[model samples]
Target: MASCILMQFPGTSDPTVTVIATGGTIASTADAQGARVPTLDGAALIAHSGTPIPTRVIDSTSLDSSSMRLADIDELAGHIQEAFADPTTSGVVVTHGTDSMAETALALDVMLDDERPVVLTGAQLPADDPHADGPENLAGAIALAALPAQQPGVQIHFGGMTLPARGALKRHTYEMQAFTSSATTPLSRPRPVGVHRLAGKNVVVIAAWPGAGRAEVDAIVATRPDGIVVAGLGAGNISADMGRALGECLQAGIPVVVSTQVPFGPVAFDYGGAGGGNTLGSLGALSAGYLSPGQARMALTVALASGTDPAVLLA
Candidate 1:
């Protein structure tokens, strides 16, 4: 079910803020059987903030980000649009599940028409946990949302840091400092100044490539011998089907980047030569080194957007 909590900023004359809840661990509760049950909403989260802020429960059910479809993202985009359209709505906060949180945040970043601050927050543990991070994350998000300078683009706030949607990634399963940005530093940090550093003009998304296509995979090598990071199979392998396609791109003298399909490790060429490893490595494909898939993508995009040599991606 859905419910909400409202909390206004204490002792501040600032305008009210609206938090839209797309339920996750924050709203979870415990059933009589002791199983986790999340039933609260945005308003409930606001109430948990200990101050009354104008809040709304846009959606009550917890939607895992990985399970989220393009349609769901579109729906969220619509809500964000509507929320910003209202002059009374200063900023918006979205409570979301950690899975695919970066993807959802990125989608919102691309789709949101306005510049109003839009923040996405969630927890790794349920609200009932003594160590649950949902409440504090929500509080931080709301605090940022109320700020006038936080406007424009979408952001993910967790563990007291704010990250740009297109750049944020969940780096840990249990650590409070889980979400991070690649290459660029985080936008907001709760410190002495509590600054949210907006990105420079260099951030961007390139035209959708055929590899990001739905059906068969295809490779697109940009004009420069730029770094091309492939989300490879286990141990940095590529499926036979994808290997053939990527081989064609590599033979053209383009650098192919290989990143592990898994989230946590480096894309290594040390795996057995089977599964497109030998084939790709022989073609001068480079490993992503320390960069995650999302980080690799962002680095590539920004480099491209900046018109820098793709070779710089390796640097």
Candidate 2:
């Protein structure tokens, strides 16, 4: 997690909410020719909202989601960890890009220690646009954060709804309602009273599993592969071709992790399916169960980076 600073006035009725501005289209403004460019700080963006919530802008440097790396995500988590430690700070809001937004959100979900709602928001267009969606999303994020409801963990608020960070994905390239929850109405919803009536389902996030994509898989098959996933189609399914690759990885002492690509489901084997899951399981490819791919990757990376057995993640 990155370091942060809290700026607030004493005796102010306003409740302080740390707004870490990581810079995205929401912070961007139109250029002279009307192209998007990064602009605005937390104060400037929230100044016109007329809400008494105090916001603190901890970081301003902006980067496209493609350019953001695991290290940057770690730093963002650092800032969030610091804010959650402050008793005066009610909650935190992170403004980021829609692209790769779910990845960061999920990353934070795993790293977060407290239950304070960490609201993430962004826009489809620059704030300079007359029809920009930044303001509303921003407002919705803060409003959710201020609520007393148990809207904890990493959740994304956009297009007027609050969704679990793990269940969110960018489904459209340029629509205001681009992000959606997986076959559900989302973990939380906005109300005249505040965010309420959470669906109360826990989203499992598994990562750092041993032999997820490299060693254990290589022992099962014999091929240099392009990509590897835990299951096939929506559940426990990986193609025969992929199964062959996993066999190779397992044989070569490289590990492969079996994670479901589906937003909701588990990675199981031999459930009377024709997909290669049973075959892959027999070949020693580790199953990630209900963990999302992002979580699995992190777990694997940490284990691999530390030179520990990737198999430990299966536990």
Candidate 3:
């Protein structure tokens, strides 16, 4: 069972922000072996934050975000939904691992529809470090979540910036400011999908290189995944052979979403050759637009799990 803690400070009002701790560097400590591991819970994290906001903490999962699966994300969504169901809950702050924070945020953005803000935050340094950034980031996320006029939908609050979940990406391996997004606002507003589980919806991401071809696509096709996301070149362009193979997958009724490997810009339909965005689009592949390849996978997973058309929902 998950532990729940309600905290009320002096001069605070009703309707408290819910802090859902799913374990990350924010809740991690160095083990005897000198390796960092998630050991702290939501209550401990809030105590470290030192933020005096009327708050409720739910210890959701103790995980190093890299170990999280789609099923784990779905379970976290249930906790968020339960928190929102309460009238006294103002907003939600999710303490997550920075590795897959953007992906989880995107999944929450598509899974839940609410006016209250859902802010995801994590630390680059482990909590035991003397210069750990978790407390400050958690305080910021809590402040954002507690704001009555905060913009709704899922957002990532890290290194002092509030980023929309859709295009948020972790750009650095070890930096205080780790995330960046190209758009000020979400590129597309998808309808909230009610997902029960993503058990068998095997969505895979394939990166396209200078010479990636049919062999790559064919290998992925052999696995018979429920969906595919092609991390194509600039403007979502792939090799002609890869495009032809992807078209065959499309003809076989497998949904393919095209995204870019570049850090910025939307996947466009500019070129019309066999491997261009135009070609992929013509072959019934949905363009991921501003979403990263990881985010596109989450969106496609949710779409497939909910019986929603990937093209219609992603558009």
How would you encode candidate 1's per-residue C-alpha lDDT over 175-232 as one tens digit per residue? 8887876535443321111111223322221222223332233424433434456776
Candidate 1 weakest ten by summed lDDT = 189-198
Q: How accurate locally, in lDDT, is each candidate? A: 0.60, 0.62, 0.88
CA deviation > 4 Å runs, candidate 1: 1-14, 32-37, 150-152, 184-230, 233-241, 245-315
Model 3 agreement with the true structure over 98-162: per-residue lDDT tens digits: 99999999888887888889999999999999999999999999999888635557999999988
Query: What TM-score does each of the candidates earn?
Result: 0.61, 0.71, 0.94
- Could you tally the backbone clashes for each prediction? 17, 44, 0
Q: Could you say which candidate leads in lDDT?
A: 3
- Candidate with the larger TM-score of 1 and 2: 2
- TM-score for candidate 3, please give it: 0.94
User: Per-residue lDDT tens digits of candidate 2, residues 1-315?
Assistant: 233444454554555778887778887887789777777766656753445656666774476664656666666766776776677677888888887777677656644656578888988988878788888888788888876646556788988877777556676789998787543544332111111111221222222232244334443233433224443455566555445555665666556677766766466676432235677677776765555565555444434443445455333
Estimate the lDDT of model 3: 0.88
Badly placed stretches (over 4 Å) of model 3 are: 9-13, 184-186
TM-score of structure candidate 2: 0.71
